[model samples]
Target: MTERKLKVYSEDEAKERLAKELPHWYVEHGWIRRRYRTNSWKGTLMVINAVGHLAEAAWHHPDITASYAWVEVRLMTHDHKGITDKDFQLAKKIEEVVQWQPGLEGGALEGTPQDDLRFAYIKYDKPKA
Candidate 1:
C-alpha cells in the first residue's frame, strides 16, 4: 500500500492539538513529549517495552529516555522534520497502552494490587477534575 503524505504541524498548532487531544503531552524543542513516572526500575522498563511494542506496530518510533523511576517519550516525524499525525497517533497509542488500568474498568481483569509495592509498576496519572 502507498503511504499517505504527512502534514507537519507548526509549534503553535502542535501545542493546540496536544492540549485538546493529549492533555498529558507537551511540545518541547521540536518533539511532542510525555513523561511517565514509574515506581522503580522495573516500572520504567515496563513502560519502555510497552512503548516500543506500540511504536513498532505502528511503524513510527519515538525517542525514549528512561531512568530508574521515569520514562520520557519524544515523538516527531523525522522524515517530515516536524510533528505530524504519525507522531500524535503513535503517542496516543503509547499513552493508552501504558496508562491502562484494568482494575478501574469493573471487570475481571483486576490490575496490580495497590497495597503491595512489589506488584506496582507505572505511577499512572490521575484524571483531572
Candidate 2:
C-alpha cells in the first residue's frame, strides 16, 4: 500500500498541538523532544530498547541519545522535513511505554527484590526513604 504524504505542522500549530496532547514534550530545533531520566545504566538500556521497538512498529523512527542515567528522544518527520502527526503519535506511545512500572502490575513483583533492580520507568532524583 502506498503511504500517505505527511503534512508538516507550522511552528504555531506544532506548539499548540504539543501543548495539548503532549505537555511534557517540547519543540527544539526542528524536532519535538522529551528526555526520560532513568535510575541507572540498566534503566537507560531498557528505555532505548523500548523506544526502538515502538519506533520500528510504528514505522516512524526518532533520534535517540542514551547515557548511563537518561535517554533523550527526538522526533520529526524527515520526509515531510518537519514535525508532523506521525511524530506526535510515536511520541505518545513512547511516553506510555516508558512510564510503565512493573511493580504496579498485579503480582509481577512478588518474591522479587525491587530495591536491587532499576526498572525502565522514568524517575527523578529524590531523597531516600
Separately for all candidates shown, the number of backbone clashes (residues 3 or more apart, or on different chains) is 0, 0
The list of candidate 2 runs beyond 4 A from truth reads 102-121, 124-129
Q: What is the lDDT of residue 93 in candidate 2?
A: 95
| Model 2 steric clash pairs | none
**Error at 108, model 1, angstroms:** 0.5
Q: After superposition, how far is residue 91 of candidate 2 from its true place, in Å?
A: 0.5
lDDT of each: 0.92, 0.82
Candidate 2 lDDT over residue span 16-123, tens digit each: 998998888899999999998977887788789999999999999999998888999999999889998899999989987776554556675643244655332457
Worst 10-residue lDDT window for candidate 1 reads: 120-129
- lDDT score for candidate 2 against the true structure: 0.82
Instruction: Compare the candidates by lDDT and give the number of the best one.
Output: 1
Displacement of residue 19 (Cα, Å) in model 2 is: 1.1
TM-score of each: 0.95, 0.81
